[model samples]
Target: MSDRDEQAYAGTAEGKGPVRIDEELARHLENKREELFEEFEIRDEFPPEVLREAEERAADPEGDIRTELEDRRDLRELTTWTTDPADAQDFDDAVSIERTDTGYRLWVHIADVTHYVAPETAMWEEAMERGNTVYLPAYTVHMLPPILAETVCSLVPNEDRLAHTVEMHIDGETLSHESIDIYKSVVHSDARQTYNDCEDRLEDPDAPLHEANSLAYELAEKLHEQRKDDGSLVLNPKRDRAHTIIEECMLKANKAVTHTLQWDRGLEAMFRVHPQPTPQEWDEALQEIQELDGVSIPGDAWDDPRKAVNATLEEAPGRQLDKIQWAVMKVMPRAKYMADPFGGHHALNFEIYGHFTSPIRRLSDLVNHWIVYTDGVPDGIGDLCDHASDKQKDGETCERIYKDFLQEVGLDPHAVNNRGIEVVDDPADAEYTA
Candidate 1:
């Protein structure tokens, strides 16, 4: 650890506040990890039986993959592709868009993890216990074994994979919705495009994929405007056009799956719910913003906090915007998983919201897929909802701890006081009066 980091941990910084740092940073992180697992009741490792089953499946990949394909529409010929970080390990979702006479036909394909790991099986039990994968800066602890997480269930390029499809038709005018269909399907990704590559494609007029890239961005702009009109909170500032396009596609798919599950009243599943801020929470947030920049929040902000919060964020100075955003988020309650979709996502302004994408990493999405296929949720889903929420919090704790450790070791210079050290030229001559 650097001297600054040691001082920060040891509570020796000049007169800010008292903090207890009795142990080394790495040792503290180890203890914190153990505490988190204990507090959240997380199972850190897969069961022996699960490992055995996964090993068997990995040995004969072809035999099991053939049996897992059923009731799947063959979409391998479509112009389908995935967009993620360049170093992304597990590719869980992909998109395909085509122009229609009245609107656009968009298909969101998510990995069908349930096809291989059925309910009540050892692998399923392990996944349920883990709740979701915890990603640290240097590594990831997956919920499933490598057989499914990295190879079988991952939607790799040029490989045929099974998936659950959310097929919807978007109106060309308002970019509003139309009919929605959910089903199991098979697809072969045309390419594994990165966000950087997508941005390049958007700018290249002569590129072969220019049309599709432009169409996706255009739809994303409309969706963004629609959300702003509905008073959705804009916590994150507008990023790259490519990032927005991928986000909008995933948001649409999640919303569609949520609505379908709600329509099928017989199904019992968890929903990604976010409650409106209480009066006290809003007051605290306003007070924080006032202290930071002496900006007064409008009185009408009480009725629609999303608009008021977003407006203030826009007006914040660029130098202090990150701090302002962090303060505002700290005052709001965290979103959680619930058994019902009564309270939708306040940040997104959606009437129904659930996680249906990234099933390979999250267990809730896998459960939703099961509901879509079997029309039933597993028993004790409510308890599972609470467990999943706690596990997510624990995962965040793990990441924070690892990040601190990395900073201590100088692996992440940004996390420490990185101002360059002053160097004296001809130090000996200067001291001895050259």
Candidate 2:
């Protein structure tokens, strides 16, 4: 935390706001982060040139959007809105959906980051080097400069911003894609909603975007059931309705884009692949789960390890849930990025899958946008896949170490994540100080 961060939570209420710490413990936390960043080779600061370029691009956002307005689809009439965490800084994706005679018409609009950060731009190169956003409790290392991402690239309400939209007509009966279209568009979001707001809207008839939120969950719930039926492993089946809506929609869009690249267009792009566990490894995980004090898996679900884990997680005792999850994770293989989609993703049980909805924080999505726009493949794509996979691992590791250090200093990572951090002069005001 910096001097600005230290003062961000100066007068937070004792129990209602951030976790307060004294100056001495705050220094220790800062020192540990520096050591960890140095050890892991993580870049925390953006180059001056990249920041300058970002500033220049963001200077006249509306004027730039006007220039491209004639070339792109104008979708300002569509009822579009974004949902994110309450503390989110940038809104990357927005969704619009409606019922059709056959099924549903869904539109997922993602930020046109390629419009601002092209291959030759400094922001693009800096984003490539960082690979993805690194998020720690109460802190974040952004892939792109915050000013640019939170400004022009953000799909804020009532502003016409450039976007890469995925329009899909889904068959409600079979839960299959009827058609898919990818294109650039100018979108106007009606409102920005929080997760809690979505939940409230689900229950309130008069709330804003109520019908849209309800219809999204109606489709999302079906998608969720279909995914599980297709042998997809859902570790968090009990997630809240708001999260389910976002996750299912993103998955559907990513899958739709990946299928278009592989089956429809026959182009080589970044694909997400996951390998399955061996039979013996599955047996070992199941045996471990069954041996737990208050956990059991049904005989029918054992035929599919993914299904088996889901069943157990839904029924297992609360106290034994962590053990059950760890057992399954111990045997599961890590998913990685690849150009070839031959192996498939076992966890999602999808023939093809790739990221497309989060260009602001992910390099793969940013590159894929360029590939889709130009209809051309970049050189050394395999090398780029490897770099993305490795850098993602590094970010996850860095986060884990930072969280562990938080525990060492007697701070609850979850609390700090939710309420943020504050520094106080008085020791009595500190939540934890050692």
Local distance difference test scores for all models: 0.73, 0.85
* TM-score leader: 2
Model 1, residue pairs in steric clash: none
Error of 1 at 156 (Å): 0.6
User: TM-scores across all candidates?
Assistant: 0.83, 0.94
Model 1, position 410, has a per-residue lDDT of 46
lDDT of 2 by residue, 149-226 (tens): 787899988899999999999998998999999999999999898777888899999989999999999999999988
lDDT string for model 1 (264-328, tens) is: 55466879888777878877776777677645556666567677777776666776677767766
